[model samples]
Target: MSAASPLRVVCLVPSWTETLIEAGVNVVGRTRYCVHPADRVSTIPVVGGTKDVNWEKVAAQTPDMVVFDQEENTQAMADSCPYPWVATNVTSVQAMPAALEQLAKALNCDALLHMAERYRAALAAPVSRSGRQLPLLSDKHNSSLSVLNDDRPLLYLIWRKPYMTVGTDTFIHSLFTHLGLPLITPGERYPEVDENWLVQHKPVLLCASEPYPFAGKLNAVKDELQLDALLIDGEPLCWYGIRSLRFLESLQSS
Candidate 1:
């Protein structure tokens, strides 16, 4: 009967939906890709993917709360929800945990506070435990490099269809910059690029993401271009919410 009790909840976006579930919230509805704790999410309702949601089915559930990314949800869906909605915008890695905290508070879940605290502590941990001084990518001089002006030109290729990528101002870029990675892509939204263009830039590191599921794709690309690169998990790198708490822990353990 109290607010602490599980509220029938729906998360219409993949990133935020996963965050809410990870924080121990009762998610009665979610997007297609909420794969963590697979069995639990399977019992919940499906409101389609991030960009496409089934409002009619969601309305049938009559949830007490609705969660989604501000960037991913449509205006019509926002207006149609009967309950109070908690919308989030995750553009970088740092902004994710806070969004998780917000979901916990909104759902009155005490477990979320622990997730938030743990995430903060993990993010604060030193990049190196060897007591040796390490350099951050952001501290480097901007004019020393070429391409997008020295700034450690790196690329965040997230999707393949349109060949999308993250810009220097985004959260992924912010994290890479913090780690002293360079930026190679321009400031526009995920620009489409061909093999020729990618090879021409001669990027030091080609960071591929998993969100749009680019793991195997990077390998083929590396072989074709004969470039050194690694396929990184896109959720941890891009989802800036309570899930970040778990992500940071993963990083520390690795």
Candidate 2:
């Protein structure tokens, strides 16, 4: 639908929900996790979480279209969708611009198209003098900072207990790759690990603030693993679309 004839859309992806809302789309329904632009999304009806969608509630809204993410929402959900649905897949930072463009075309939102071009230009811009990189591992007790080497492996932890980490094919990995960090984790997706595995691999540890609140237990993790770990914000690394574009812009300005 064109901007003049706005379609009633339901967005399941958190980042996409924010993007659509910012683009002035008539977002009729959103997943519970779509919390950005807090003032606006708070009024939108919550269908459910990303993985568990209430199709009944979704249908109640009579949305003309529903937006789904290839990774966040299950294939079954897409198959079950009664209304016309659009699926967005952003597995790498390099693919974000095209993904935004595709979504813009599907919704006929010129704002998203402009965002896509801006995002593309931001990606092409040179890294600032401060260095366009995520926070490095620093020890609180010691003044020495661990240097990141291209040859060495960096492991970014997302979950706890089993200590789940990301694989090379994930969006998180792509973010790190863009930051010039080498990830050594193996497997296709989130992989569970134990203390033994961490000891064996001896990778530089980075704990993320989301998917799990790694920041709260940062010291405990360092003490348990006997390794220097840094807490990193998960938004810029995982959240794509508008959030990612803003992050790239911030980096350029910095």
Candidate 3:
């Protein structure tokens, strides 16, 4: 398929959905979970969720391309896709600008070029002033909340049942590192932690709002941990792309 001005596309992940919309690409299909910039996807068809999409609905859309992520999507699922697909990986916050550039080229979306530029511009500000040591920044949008200081090692809780937390060397980890916080979990990727583990090794907890929203979901046990806890809007923190650049926060206290 010609990368230039694709007819229509299917987005299998949330960040990819945000990227495609920002790139001004025509997205005919999106997963039910792709809710970023909800105005753009309100009318779009739902193929399925990130892990399991309806191939028949996706094929019927006859999209020129399907965008998936190396992190959020599986290689097996990509192999089964009949349409031409663009796989993007924003491995780190430092690499995100370049990743945006690569995705634009793959989808032939010129609008996305601005996203890369925006990403670079965000990093050049307060982040650079701090000597780029990864000081955790306070959420710019949530101005009411005071800056956190007790950085006893922060934890990003993505799921509940199996108890999965964001692990080292991940995009989320990089974001936190860029913000200047230390992660306590020490596994390769997303690591599962049980209640015993949480109680034993209590870290500053950040419960994600998606992929299993944890705001009200885990409050009971979150209080039991007896550690500073906050609800992290997962989008700007974990989701890589234009949205992250826009949500680049300022540090109130490091």
lDDT top scorer: 2
> What do the candidate models score in CA lDDT, each in turn?
0.62, 0.80, 0.72
Instruction: List the lowest-lDDT window of 10 residues for candidate 3.
Output: 128-137
Ranking by TM-score: 2, 3, 1
Better TM-score candidate (1, 3): 3
lDDT of 3 by residue, 24-120 (tens): 7888999988887888899899999888888999978989888888877889889998888888776788888888787778777667777788778
Number of clashes recorded per candidate: 17, 0, 5
Give the alpha carbon lDDT tens digit for every residue of 144-229 in model 1.
Answer: 22333333335666766555677765777766654445356755555666677776876644445465655446556556555544
Off by over 4 Å in 1: 1-5, 128-153, 194-200, 205-209, 212-220, 223-226
- Candidates 2 and 3: which is better by lDDT? 2
Best prediction by TM-score? 2
Per-prediction TM-score: 0.75, 0.89, 0.82
Put down candidate 2 lDDT per residue, 15-71, tens digits, no spaces: 999888888889999998999989999899999989989989998899988999999
